[model samples]
Target: MSTFPGTAEFYRQFRPGLPGALPTLLDQIAPAASPRRLLDIGTGPGLVVEALLERFDDIVALDSDASMVAVAESALRTPLPHGSRLQLHHGRAEEFTPSAGWQPHLVTFCRVFHWLDQSAVLARLGEYVAPEGVVAVFSDRSLWTAGNPWQRAVRDVVQDFLGTQRRAGNRTFESPGPPHTQVLRDSPFSEVTETVIPVRRTWSADDVIGYLYSTSFAAPYLFGGRRANFEAAVKTVLAHFTTNGVLLENNAFTVLTAHRPSRHGKR
Candidate 1:
């Protein structure tokens, strides 16, 4: 289910970019230094990878989806900064291993940590990160589930077309488990802190439709022959809330950062 074989293009075109404050926050957490490296798991489209290159000289961007990796490669074709290198890997987080002599200073899982075995991944990070490095997990609610009348209307339309229940690639969408704080508290890398960034975005009706397709819950393949009908219905619902053909959303991005316990310090 991680590989959005059909939604890759939509994902590349419509997925939200990381907040503008992200790089500065990252710099504060792990300052730029020579030989610095980052391991970005679930690096959809390489958005974070592209941003971190300005700070880290070496990066390993890994994703479970080949299509996503391909998109990342295409988007990052521009020459990298001098002394910087990026290596892209197509694999799951549990399976990735850095080359010998390569240890990451920062490990990032943006919106993808929930899909992983949280404790196991944190345990592996203890073996991979440099001293005082961090493991950052970030996420925000999807537009369909946001607390807005227009968003509710859109969600209703999606349910009408698909079903009352949410879907993820052919399976029922189960609610994700405990908050990351709880998960992190029980993991090896347990010194956790969080930052919340308020976000407001305006999207055109068409943009909203495109964004819906980019998600597993509303992917076009789920609609089969009804895809056009679904899109039209979504547009009608969105039009009712649009002023000047744009829908506005107020959302927040939360970053949960877990510090890798110092080797000499007691856990």
Candidate 2:
């Protein structure tokens, strides 16, 4: 789990651009209905919930951490222009059982898919989604291929902190999208779409440092929870501070959406 405080703060930090991965997710959800209800899995801090509520009505956001849930609850309590329909739940998708008649029109997970038991999560998530509702999983690709020296420096520093364990399951910033998305192709989902969304993040040195320490990879294993080590690595890489901002390369995102198979046996 990530030790970063205030989950909502991370979303606020990363949302500006932090790799343009949103389009891929947006495209898969094309022909998006005015989603009446959405189930957001592992809704850390609620950025994705905010994203969904921006496009839909009545969102049910989930996260396992109480603090994260608390932060999300505080961040998402207000209604948007359309209506007040967002609900925050503190729980895991695998252990979450929806009451009868509580199907949702859209289901999603932003960056937290990697932390889940993918098989069990998919099986359980199968229940909450309304018929023909879609399941989209998203992640930023900027971690792998950096467009410029600025981002490359940040990537290197963060990766070094992540160590080999985090890298072993790593996918290139540009590739076939999520591994689980591939693993899921044979069954529950009827179609799988992998698309790239190119975007960029302009980071000052301060923004860069916070983002590095915010990552789950940099949490503790390698740094021993000593943030100075993480900060030192960032300083080492960001040797050149130019006005141009970071011309981050391919600092994009890949989104894989697996449309749930219609009328599953479990359902």
Candidate 3:
């Protein structure tokens, strides 16, 4: 089954953007000369694409889901930088091959790397990365996933509606094999490091409902005929936690970077 079937609309509307420190962090971890190229694997709704366009003149955004590609195309309708270009492809990361004469200085997988075979995907990337290029994997836990009081309350409501464990399109969700850092250490991209940035946001009950629908584990489509009931219950629970109709979400975003050693044996 598709990871996010029928959830593109909700994802585009509610998915969080990268943290403000991301640009600076990328510069430090994956510095490149002018006319840089980027490949964004699993580029849902073009959030990463939009964020990096100013720094990269050429970008290739790939996703296995057609609906996500369509929404990303729509979101990128605004004028890009003078010479910037974005090419969207509907394909899996393992199957993607960069066009002839195109070498990416940086390849990024945000929030979707857990869905891929880490070893295979990193191995395939060796063929596309330019010298000294880096591969960055990023993700931020959702409020419901954290064990805070309000977050736990929200998770309880979801569990009561669905179940204790998560589900994805008729399949029980399975934990990813190994930590990404460990996987990167074992892969060809052995030079691995990570950065964490704290982020906070205020969310309304309505915002929480939208965010819930955007996630694969709790998408509205997963509930089928009971979607409405699930949404109502979530809103009712969130309302209890809301102060002035807003709930505070304090979360941390992490970026793990991997690359081959440089001439001096440094990352």
Candidate 4:
């Protein structure tokens, strides 16, 4: 689990929200008459809950990082809008223990599954998730994996300061094994479906810099006394990529929803 002590605020400020139609797609998984309960795992700044607040009446937003959880609490104030109940927990996803008699209708992982012990967490979820429920993993193609020139320039500037190694918190980042789809198939939730939502974003040089700070790879603290210099360098490089003071990119956000086959053997 990663802690975002210095980067939590920037993450809250710059992270992109879910696509507008995502909540509707998630809401359709549960029966219309049933009260929808959501367990949003690794819910940084309560982004998922904020987006799906009206759809799910009960929400438990969990994050391993205390600072991130605190940010979420401040952003999603108590007695949430539309009468939703939002509970914030600071704990690791793999070690999470659900409340007594709690069976959430849907459990979600937003840009966080890669940090978890996927098989172990899924095993634990099987005990508390409703029989007809689903697990949705949401993530987007990161700027780190640049598909365009402007993104590549931002990435190059970041690497020049932070070194070429990908960082996850204090450690060099490594992709988790077996892939998410293969891991899900090996678990109780064998039925899997994927949806890719294409999105367009426009960013100013400042926005790019702020977004860089929001990531584990290039957070300000990682620069030590050179943070200011790093910021200046980033702005200089981004100037070449901007058009009318902004940069644009078409990105793909994907959702992987998985569930156990129904008793009737239907997916």
- The superposed Cα distance between candidate 4 and the true structure at residue 114, in angstroms, equals 0.3
Residue range 1-267, candidate 2, lDDT tens digits: 434443345544544432324634553464354446678888777777666555667667888877778877877776454565777788777799776777766677777776677777777766666767777777774343445766766766666666434432222222334576575685466477776676644566666665544454443334656667777777666757546544333355567777765533222
Per-residue CA lDDT of candidate 3, range 52-163, in tens? 8788888899999999999999988585777788899999998889988788878899999988987889888887687788889989996556755787888888889789
Model 4 spans > 4 angstroms off: 263-267
Backbone atom clashes (below 3 Å) for every candidate: 0, 3, 0, 0
| Per-model lDDT | 0.82, 0.61, 0.83, 0.84
Better-scoring candidate (lDDT), 1 or 4: 4
Ranking by lDDT: 4, 3, 1, 2
Model 1, span 1-267: residue lDDT tens: 563657778888898888889877876787345688889999888888877778888889999988899989988768578777889999878867788878787899987887787778777777878777777888878866789889899999988888888877778777878879988877776888899988989899889888988888898788889988888898888888999988889888898878745533311
Collision count of model 3 = 0
- Give the least accurate 10-residue stretch of model 3, judged by summed lDDT: 258-267
| 248: Cα error in model 3, Å | 0.4
Flag regions of model 2 displaced more than 4 Å: 1-11, 14-35, 142-152, 155-178, 220-233, 244-249, 261-267
Q: Report RMSD (Å) for each prediction in the order shown.
A: 2.4, 5.3, 1.8, 1.9
Q: How accurate is candidate 1 locally (lDDT)?
A: 0.82
**lDDT assessment of candidate 3:** 0.83
Q: Considering TM-score, which of the candidate structures 1 and 3 is the better prediction for this target?
A: 3
- Spell out the clash pairs found in candidate 3: none
